[model samples]
Target: MHTIFEPMKPIPFSPPRIDEKTIEAVTEVLRSGWITTGPKTRELEKKIQQYIGGGPVLCLNAWTNAVELMLRWMEVGPGDEVIIPAYTYAATANIIIHIGAKPVMIDCEPNGFLMDLNKAEAAINENTKVIMPVDFSGLPVDYAAVMEMAKRHAGIYKPRGENQSKLNRIMVISDAAHSFGALYDNTPVGREVDVAAFSFHAVKNFTTAEGGALVFNLPAPFDNEAIWKDINRKALHGQTKDALSKTQAGQWQYDIVEAGYKCNMTDLQAALGWVEMDRYAQDHLPRRKSIVARYNQAFQSCSWAILPKMQDDIVESSYHLYALRIQGFNEDDRNALITHLAEMGISTNVHFQPLPRLSFYKNMGFQESDFPRAFEQFSNEISLPIYFDLTDEQVDCITSAIKDYMQSR
Candidate 1:
């Protein structure tokens, strides 16, 4: 155990980088009186659409809700199956379950957290309605390969007894929680896939305190305006008009189209988002990238460390996480290392436990051995602190502590 002369300062793993500007913006919203879905939210949506090129952006209370809404909009339900990675957060699979669909979990690439396209191809069946790929730790997946796979499997993988001649397009929904600012082949992440749901949680790179957005890039003949309107109604109590629209003269009365989920983003949250989005590329992304580079350099000298890959010909990550794998470390050893880091006043976290390892998923017939690569990566991975405000000295201290712990072990 490490002892300290002065009190050991707790370094939180990942905290919101809120400053005076964010505080002031939130205060402004509070003072504005219209705190619900209003002008601010619309402005934020527009700005986000512009930021990620052009697309139909819909703001929501959470990314989970956005994904569920997308599933609902796409008409994915019972007798349907959605392909997802076994290594992702439960929310990705849970949403499919929510809509009465089968979540066909696939194995990740060897030593990499992203989905293996080959395994994804093997998992596709007649019932496969969607291929939901996750951009794990801000690294964009191979969108072109996924697109090609979807095209190849379109005609053959149709409902049993249905006309095999008609191409059954498998929608590609991207769970882009950590990839708001990520890029695939110089194009933004949102525009790469058919649809993408981005998280603006406090811990994410670009935050709205507690918010998320969906970007739709549907093909021709699909009315983007109609889809946008339906999503807007569905998010706001299924009402024909939102509070802002109803407040206008001679528009007080409206009708409920469907029983929809109440998951609209508030103006207060959007106010912070608007400011954060403006400064994201200029201030936040570069700082986080710098931190990741420093961490990579520090761990490069350690033989036991297997750093996360951030480079590729087709992708550029947003640096949302620095997931480091410790060679020759079991789950217990990783836990012991985390405890050791805590004792040394450094905080760390595990990205996820393979979904099958969890009791709920296990009860649902998933097994750990079914996803060998995911389980292996999950057991050894540790996410270090990498945020905008984390200083260079703190980075040095964190690396030194890890080196010392490794030597001691």
Candidate 2:
């Protein structure tokens, strides 16, 4: 009955850290019988607004929906261009194409996975309407530089040969899927940008099972209340009222205002979010930070390990993913290392493959050489197991496996 060599139970890269509170909240939601976009969802939105500072927060089914909805709200359409980082989840750039707008990919910073602000500025043209900076792996991109670039470009550029007062007023839409609890310059990620879409996917730090929230920081003339109502309509089949709204007596009558997508967050999902948010900073974040610190301490001595920067004066990551780069390793070498880790019962993953290398974007004319840094990082990066329940012993095993694999090679 000795099971000592039984593959160490297969440590997952990232798993939802659910607890009894989440269970109770979900059960309460089930008993309430009013589950679709109801009180709990509104409560979650209000809590998120307070958590990230004052801003309009709209809960949705996914960050993808939030991004697409924001693009639609801004009237981004065919012939319009949206600048995005080459190193990001497909959701960040895919929404641009989904709205028929062209996605202009930008390179990442050298030795960093964040968007290259200089390249982003250079990519701006007359047709550019949005500068979508992804907070890759929870590290906030330099928003100050991005905002400055947007301001500097405001007056000189002209779109469609029209003379507008500010040509450089590109909307700053942050793909903050990995940075919900992250901060830039002491301000939360959502509040700093014009708008940010946060993912609450099952594997995210904060899980809503399958949900997201849109944080809007656009200034005057763009009424936050109106925008909220518009997004609500859009999320629920363009209907004037949702299921909860219709539940009230003599209020069942509603109408479709415009053609919209079904992407509203259910109360069931929000129930989980409410509990997760309550414990976010006080409980969850601390544990994750501890795990990251342990991982950093373990791997910092390795010459071949290029660890991700977790914090600085201007940035504080959410510690969403630990992207470990294998220095001097090619794509094949990295792949071999991952395979070797798997053989030793350590689970690992890659954050992403640069969008340009994907067949869809490649066929759209993107070149790997177009973004050398992103490609370089993509070729050698591996995301290690990081979660609340991962034991210190498991962490040591993962690091040891990596070191053994590299040294033996």
Q: Highest TM-score, which number?
A: 1
lDDT of 2 by residue, 1-409 (tens): 1122435878887888887888999999899887778999999999999988957899999999988988887778789899999998888888888989999998889899998888888888777888888888899888878777766776654444221222337778888899989988786678777788899999888889999999877766567777788888888889998897787899999998888899999999999999988888887888888889988997898898898999999999999999989889899988988888887778889988999989999999999998999988998999998887888888877876777666666
Clashing residue pairs in candidate 1 are none
TM-score of 2: 0.95
**Model 2 — which ten-residue stretch has the worst lDDT?**
159-168
Query: How do the residues 265-356 of candidate 1 rate in per-residue lDDT, one tens digit apiece?
Result: 99999988978988998888899989999999989978999999886888899999999999999999999999988987889999888889
Off by over 4 Å in 2: 1-7, 156-168
State each model's CA lDDT, in order.
0.87, 0.85
Q: Candidate 1: how large is its RMSD?
A: 2.6
Model 1 lDDT, residue 96, Cα: 91
Q: What 10-residue stretch in candidate 1 is worst by lDDT?
A: 159-168
